[model samples]
Target: MAPIINGRLLFNQLPNGLPVPGKTTVYDASETIDLETAPLNGGILVKILVLSADIYIISRMRDSSVEGRSSPFLLNQPIDNYGVGLVLRSEHSSFKQGDHIYGMLPFQQYIVMPPATAERFTVLSNDAGIPWSAYVGVCGMPGQTAHHGWREFSKAKVGETVFVTSGAGPVGATVIQMAKAEGLKVIASAGSDEKVAFIKSLGADVAFNYKTEDTREILAREGPIDVYWDGVGGEALEAAIDAASVGARFIECGMISVFTGEPYHVKISFNIVTKELKISGFIVTSLHQAHLSHFYETFPKLVKEGKIKYKEDVTQGLERAGHAIVDVITGRNKGKSVILVGEE
Candidate 1:
């Protein structure tokens, strides 16, 4: 017998700031599907096991028409992001009942994808020896973002000094460690003292709380930086521009400071020409195929050997997903924000 599925929907659009609780509605539905009687036409039904709560989802909530990305969630539709799930029934040749998979999925308890969309799902290997949550995190998109941002965008070389902002967050944390592994001298900045220490423990040569210190002064003292991996924009980006060495590469992965509809005015435009710096902005989706493949092949080995480390700040239950997203955007989360939707 198929189980009843409860789903969460975005009840309203967030025009400016943080998400409100009532904006995400939860309701029970009577819809159910029997695996035996399900039609085999390249469709698949999955039981969602984990949902990733990230600032990127917040960006989507603010505007539904973000070009080169998934269409924004409709007024009453379920929010979608990366998720891990178990196949309950499958009509696709690549998947079968009982298979675990990861892909872009909704925040609901169960989902049905038609033939065209079903191709987005990828089967998870049980022998991978990593937690499912890792698939939505370190071993997933964030990991790929870090790897490709450094290798292709930043073009960091051995012994060069690199600075990373929001170093305690998923992508920044991975960037810090990967830079260290490749023999780069790494300096990291975070919002709080605890987060500063966390990045330091991950092998950052120097870590500081940007909240308490002036980023410009800190970078001036520690820099002449060859590469800058920017996760937080606004003031941090201005600081990087001012502190960059000649021919430095600035890889812009995100701008969390302005994601909540805050007004941002870039004040360091003049420095770009004066310093001969190369600035590039990237979305992980553009480099997904090559970087994701390289990350999967290499990252797990580093995780097993203790050369890389990751952390997930998980909130239990799907209901807390909104709160988790708010917490991560506001710097309240200590690690990667994740919603534990089911038992491992």
Candidate 2:
């Protein structure tokens, strides 16, 4: 077979703020590979089909000496995120040709899965027949984050009110639905009226545009928040802390405002002691071994039955990946941002 374009996005430089496409990150299209003849070396050859643009990836774009959720991205290397891909060829027992793999795959059109790093990639059973794109978005890591984050952190009784920050995101939207499903009142916020409407459509009982509304006033009016689904950190977190009910549980799933700058001062730090507020944060991957299978089995069925609403904002091409990731970082994406690198 003829050689093919192996366009890959690289961490060209460390970002000072939100990364600029083609500047801090380099989209290299000059690379090419003969997929039919590429050596697998006891691993797999995969056509990168779908890539998720997640906020978590932004934290990894930093100095190697700096701490992050994972290792910092090495300069000139293909940066990666959670994605589902199609295996074109495989030299492993657990995977075979035509199997779809899910893991932290690089932002490339094609990738060689050398055995050394292939340990992280797992075959997507896809038993529910959910769209492969969903496997990278609502049914993927973000969903697991919401499901387990809610299940583990939320111990509120029925009729409780939970305020979900960054409420229009993949994780927040899912949390909103789950809270409503369990008979809890959902108060969530987004960056725009459109996003506020989207979360309301998912049954958020009280949805607000945090960008325009006074975060503190609104949470105070509608809450004594029984649970704070804290995806947004910084000032929003400060507001949530003030609005929290005595003994409120704070579920820390993400702190995305690191890109937006840290505006949090914890002036009400005394509440943690006086109110007995329970604040807990979890790295979703650490909890997935016991819970991800339940998410994989149940969330897709809920989405399919229209019982749990979900959405995917699919960017059309790999060339747009850098922009797609920027959208996630800046809260510009309308739904779960996914870069469609190839036909699923």
Best by TM-score: 2
TM-score of each: 0.93, 0.97
lDDT of 2 by residue, 1-344 (tens): 99988989899998878899998788888999998999999989989889999998888998999976688999999898888889898898778899998999999989888887777887887776778888877788998999988888799689999999888999999999899989999999999998999998999889999878898888878888989998878888888888888999999888888566655555668988888999998998988987888888798888778887777788987778889988998889989998998874
Q: What stretches of model 1 exceed 4 Å from their correct place?
A: 24-41, 63-70
lDDT per residue (tens digit) for residues 41-99 in model 1 = 67987778988887777667745556635466667677778989988888788888888
Q: Count the backbone clashes (under 3 Å) in each candidate.
A: 0, 0
Candidate 2: TM-score? 0.97
* C-alpha RMSD values across all candidates: 2.1, 1.3
Backbone clashes in model 2, listed as residue pairs: none
True-vs-predicted CA distance for residue 97, candidate 1, Å: 2.0
Q: What's the distance in Å from true for residue 26, model 2?
A: 1.4
